[model samples]
Structures are given as structure tokens and as C-alpha cells.
Target: MTQLPPRFEISRQDIARVVAVFYERIRGHPGLGPVFAAHVDDWPSHEAKVTDFWANAILHERSYDGNPVEVHRRAGNVRPGMFDTWLALFDHVLAREVTPQQAQAWSALAHRIGRTVRAGVVDQAKGPGGVPILR
Candidate 1:
């Protein structure tokens, strides 16, 4: 059995800090802001949910249970291309808010999630024979 890398010692406070900063940037971004605004009716609740998600993912807390892929698919406004902008903002905030080790560890997970979400969106948009449907 392959041993997993030792988890980074990030606290819930640290996760909350990063989530707060990251979402603040997302809410202000031209491309992402409107997309989020269209889907998210309650900012505080959404922020709390996101914080829980990050805390669970990074700190191994078992608090978050929602299916992120299904959430993004239901969002309808999120496209595959948006992951780039999201990750860029995420990387920026992660660098400023966390230690280098934390940033690296969190970024790897974030990128994997981003790619999965993007693929889910893309596959949903594609028809048989791998051709993308015109929106």
C-alpha cells in the first residue's frame, strides 16, 4: 500500500481565513462575480459552506458532505473555462494567506478538484462522439 504524504498542519482558522480572502476576490471578479451572484442567493451561507468544504478537504475534517460536481453542474453558469480564473485567484489568495507548505498542499487539492469539476462540466456539455454542443 502506498503511504499518503503527511498532511499539512493547517487549522480551521487558517482555512477560514483563506476562504474569506478567496471568495472576496471571487465576488469582485468581473468574469466570476456575475456567475456567482446569479447562483448564490445567500452570501453568508455560501461562504460558510465553502469554508466548511475547505476545512474538510485540507484539514481532514468530516464536516462537508455535498457533492461539489453536482453543485457546479446545477449552478448552470459555471463553465469549464472558468476554472482557470478561479484557480488563479485561489493561488493568489493561498500564497498570501498560508505558509508555503500549506499553499502547496492546498493548491494540489484545489487543482485536482478544479480539473474534476471542469471535466464534469465539459462532459455534460458534450454530445456523443465527443463533440461539444453549441450553447
Candidate 2:
């Protein structure tokens, strides 16, 4: 019989820590930094918002109230394919910050949210001909 890994409760502090580290990486990333800088005017506030989002998501805390899809759609410089880079960086950060199971769970949630946001951005970018420009 195969043994399963022990389940550990993830806390808000853990989420905050991960968010802090992840954004630090993002701030230094050549591909993602410029894109983020164009949209985010305040790094501290943005980090807090992201930490709240993840804490609410992972812990079911109901702390985040903003619509992420709308936010992403409003980011004109955010390309559809940027989610891939974002997720890759997120996964890399998670691997160093959390257990494998935790990382997998968080990564899955991130991917799902990323797809939803990307779809919204794509849909909003449709031309009058109803064709997406694939940006």
C-alpha cells in the first residue's frame, strides 16, 4: 500500500510569506518587472492586496473583495501568455517555500485563476470583427 504525505494546515502567515517572496522575485524578473511596473504604482499596497488574495484563496478567509479578472483586463500591457511566466515563477517560489503537496495545491489554484483572468483579458480585446488579436 502506498502511503500519503501528512497534511499540514496552511496559515495566513505562510501565504503572506510566500506572497512576499514571490513578488520579490517578480520585481527582479526582467520579463515580468517592466510589465508590472507599468501597472503597479505602489509596490507595498500591491503586495498587500496579493497577500490578501492568496490568504483568502488558500484559507477560505473571505478577505479579498476585488475582482481579479477585471483588474487583469484593465492591465493593457499584460499579454495573454504572461500567465505562463507568472505561474513558472510562482511554482519556483513555492517549491522553495512550501511542501510539495502545498505547492501543488497552490499552483493548481493559481493556474485556474490565471486561465480565468487570461480568458477575460482575451475576451475584452476582441475586435469589432469578433476576432481576438492574440496579444
Top candidate by TM-score = 1
lDDT of 2 by residue, 1-135 (tens): 554332336887888899889989999999999999888888889988998887777766666889998888888888777888999999999999998989988888898988899888888887778988565
lDDT of 2: 0.84
lDDT of 1 by residue, 74-127 (tens): 887777888888998999999999999889888999999999988888778777
Could you estimate the TM-score for every candidate? 0.88, 0.87
Q: RMSD, model 1, all Cα superposed?
A: 3.3
What residue pairs are clashing in model 1? none
Q: Model 1 off-target regions past 4 Å?
A: 1-6, 127-130, 133-135
